[model samples]
Target: MIISHKNILVSGKHQKSIVTDVFYTNEIVQKPVVIFCHGYKGFKDWGAWDLVANAFAKAGFFFVKFNFSYNGGTVEQPIDFSDLDAFGHNNYIKELDDVESVLDWITTTHTEYTDFIDTTKITLIGHSRGGGIVLIKAAEDARVQKLITWASVSDYKNRFPKGADFEKWENSGVYYVKNGRTKQEMPHYFQFYTSFIENKERLTISRAAKKIKIPHLIIHGSEDPTVSIEEAQKLHAWNRNSHMLIVKEADHVFGTKHPWSQQYLPNALQKIITESVSFAIF
Candidate 1:
């Protein structure tokens, strides 16, 4: 039977709490650990991620997924954007530190789950913006044994605004982007760009990808409009040893969407999950 520990708070970045969830089976048997990081504007319970976590648990792996403390979600509310202020203040350094805190929590603080976790075989999986986070984490931390990225961005600096728009953001201090699903105006403080600049070398996804010596799998949807397939190609090019897969018609979310209500995963997402499982196992 799969056991799930939901809505647990893990201390992270500046004492803020990271809302975390863990899924696993067989309490007595040690299983490979998989830590998943959600993307920009994403939470631990977004869409079919719970299903994905259960899939990993059923496969005899200790799976963990968490909100990045500043992803706009609070400890009381782990889904959707609740605190736009925190979200606006978020930066790459905070996210990287959050991942480290989760790793520390699982390996040291959470002794109760130690029996079911294999710390030495930890794998980091990230989706979209998360893919970039995991890549940098995996490169810097020796604790991670394997790495996987789903629909990841190859560059971060390029994602930032340039020229006049950049000047406008600098002058205004914060810029807003309307969340299509939530229809909420999301704010990005100019400090976000400054933070990235402060850690530019460390936050470079391509640099981290090249530095990774562990097995890495890169998966992307060919039709993903949010992040193009060429980004995956760039990742593959940077890491000659890494494996890449282009899902024929899958989109950024792998055919899954917010508030996914179906009992089963979308075909494309299922295929990605199967591939990820195989990659994690072998």
Candidate 2:
């Protein structure tokens, strides 16, 4: 199997461009498409994601991964958090718009690859916050045929600061979140909360998951400290028809850390890719 890669930029909401990567092979005709959405502070080049994309491509599917327009990564620097201002202005609604914008590009501007892709069989795979965005998109968008989330959050409400931190945020107009791995100061503007209030129903992941008429897979880590396993159970309860898998020892990132330099995929991360690809094809 000859795996091919393409890096493209798609125009997104708020005049920003979403930097994306396309992985596929010319071996098959009309292969399925899987769009991967990175979570908070995550970019297309994070950790072993490139290897993960290659695994999916080798599994007979066209894989697409992209950095959200306001995900703090610029086209020139797609690996690090270089655009703090854009990150501060990001909101759930804008993320939804970003995913839709990518879909529009794949279905329209990227038609040149129609011979190698089956547009009707689009599947979305999101990790963490990206998972929530994909859940909402799957419910609202008719083009999404299947959905999958890894270490996903159950809700986006109340994720902002609280108490003294909340007070500081209200007074300062922006709150800073420290990225433990990069040690970079990330900003979350007050508009992030206002946008949630403005589009409460539209941004509700649980509500959107309940309305999904297609197959859905919920993958969570039992030892995940960032998002408890209970969140996955809650997602399964809301969407009982959806399948759920709890990897016993996996962490928030399934044992894959940033700056991962190994040529081989970590065991836990490989398992995640296997399950995701299996569910996607099933």
Task: State TM-scores per candidate.
Answer: 0.98, 0.97
The residue-by-residue lDDT of candidate 2 on 1-282, one tens digit each, is 656554588998779889999888767598899999999889889999999989998998989999999999888888888889999999988889999999998888887688888899999999999999999999988999999999999899858778999899989999998999888889999999988989998887789888988999999988999998988998999988999989989999999888989999977888888999988884
- lDDT at residue 205 of model 2 (Cα atoms): 78
Expressed as tens digits, the lDDT of each residue in 155-228 for candidate 1 is 99999988999999999999999999999999999999999998899998889989989999999998999998
RMSD of each: 0.8, 1.2
Stretches of candidate 1 above 4 Å error? Answer: none
Worst 10 residues of 2 by lDDT: 1-10
Best by TM-score: 1
lDDT of each: 0.93, 0.89
So what's the TM-score on candidate 1?
Answer: 0.98
Could you tell me which 10 consecutive residues in candidate 1 have the lowest summed lDDT? 9-18
